[model samples]
Target: MLTDYHVHCEFSDDSVYPMEDVVRDAIGLGLEEICFTDHVDYGIKVDWDSGEEIRWRNGEPFANVDYPRYFAKIADLQEKYGDRIRIRRGLELGVQSHTIDAYNRLTEKYPLDFAILSIHQVHDQEFWNGEFQEGRTQGEYNEEYYREMLRVVQSFKHYSVLGHMDLIVRYDKAGVYPFEKVKDLITEILKVVIADGKGIELNTSSVRYGLSDTQPSRDILRLYRELGGRIITLGSDSHRPDHLGAHIASSMELLKELGYEAFCTFENGRPVFHPL
Candidate 1:
């Protein structure tokens, strides 16, 4: 079955695509299942109904999903269109080491089907704006990024998988860092995740982003398999209509080629694997 495990809609701080329109688009595109993994960066962004001011990045308002409204809309859509498509509630949780308690509180209150634990910002500094990379050499930044990922994976256990496990490469101005340099850290992270019975996400946005490496990089995936980490997921990481369901088939093909037997979807926080 065709599925896009990572999706965003109007609820996400960085996206403006309404939930209804995204659902219709996914159904029209012949997708069997989709999880709305909208953004939630607690420390840097406020909740939509937090009664505080909303922040904007480059003129786009950034706020965490208004959970009450977001889930109600999802439930309504599920009842209305359950026969046509399977819709699952998910969040792309951007976590920092200091914000684990906040995430635990928020997640405990919801019935999320899936959650992508991502390190979008470390020490409250974002890589896209060069805040995290500034005042540091490429090696310094890259090492720091892996260190952060390892720390989160070791400490946080609420998420289903690590989102774009190697996302730092997307913003590395010095070009792709050598995997061998940080292979030990990456391996340790994967080991901890596998031990914790968690998985990693294959975010296909790398293709549209024109990234030379896969979202988590090929080496990471291979290493996951080598470490006997079998629970992997496929996601387009879509924020717009055109981005929805992109590269899914090719990603499956790639996974099969890499000897990964299955990809996965989630329901109630448990993985349901599908042949690659």
Candidate 2:
């Protein structure tokens, strides 16, 4: 009855869990269906020099990921658990606004059941490597981040859902670019995403890390709804087995309170609603 649209496996440069563990965890959590959206970022440019920390090393923006191996593993899991659980194959493609041609190559290679197009890198920089937090006024940094993210949404025509709307704010500890400062921009971003027929995700990763109530928060979600942004997916952005279905109850409650009657789920790449 519950589903998590975002999960990562060893194929991702950051995650280390084998596909079996991911499937096992999903089963344990009673997830009727779950999607393993492995990393599909190309040319993200990380510090490929010196002995980097494990988090940075394992999760450094880019990797020579084995796509064939990834698909094979997913196929194996799908067959292995076909009766007990519904395992959906998916990928989270990192988007760089200017690299549509490369992204086109990726789409050509892998036909995913679902695809999450995210702005993990901006201005040729990686946010996960902590590079996005480097010296700059917090306000300036967040504005720049959101602007780049909006550009990403506008430039790409692919992707089933927009992973996390205000993901850059996860780094804004000082409340610098407060929701108010980014309200208009957030509205515009949602307009573009909705107009393009893409969905937004209520990523619970922010809650797990104690960063914020949700990745985009109440204000943004409300704004999104008010602006006619309907399709919304819920994901933990889980990189490990234990994190599967991390905060569905809480996130669902938040969505209902925000006046949303349903959350979006996908079946064969089509949006379906599960009433909240």
The best candidate in terms of TM-score: 1
Which residue pairs show backbone clashes in model 2? none
Give the winner by lDDT: 1
Which 10 successive residues of model 2 have the least lDDT summed? 46-55
Q: What local distance difference test score does each model get? A: 0.93, 0.78
Residue range 1-276, candidate 1, lDDT tens digits: 899999999888778899999999999999999999988997899887788999787788878888999999999999989999999999999999889998999999997899999999989999999999999999999999989888888888999999999999999989999999999999999999999999999999999999997888889999999999999999999999999999999999999988899999999999999987
Per-candidate TM-score against the hidden true structure: 0.98, 0.89
Off by over 4 Å in 2: 45-64, 128-130
Q: Candidate 1: misplaced stretches above 4 Å?
A: none
lDDT of the structure predicted as candidate 2: 0.78
Clashing pairs in 1: none
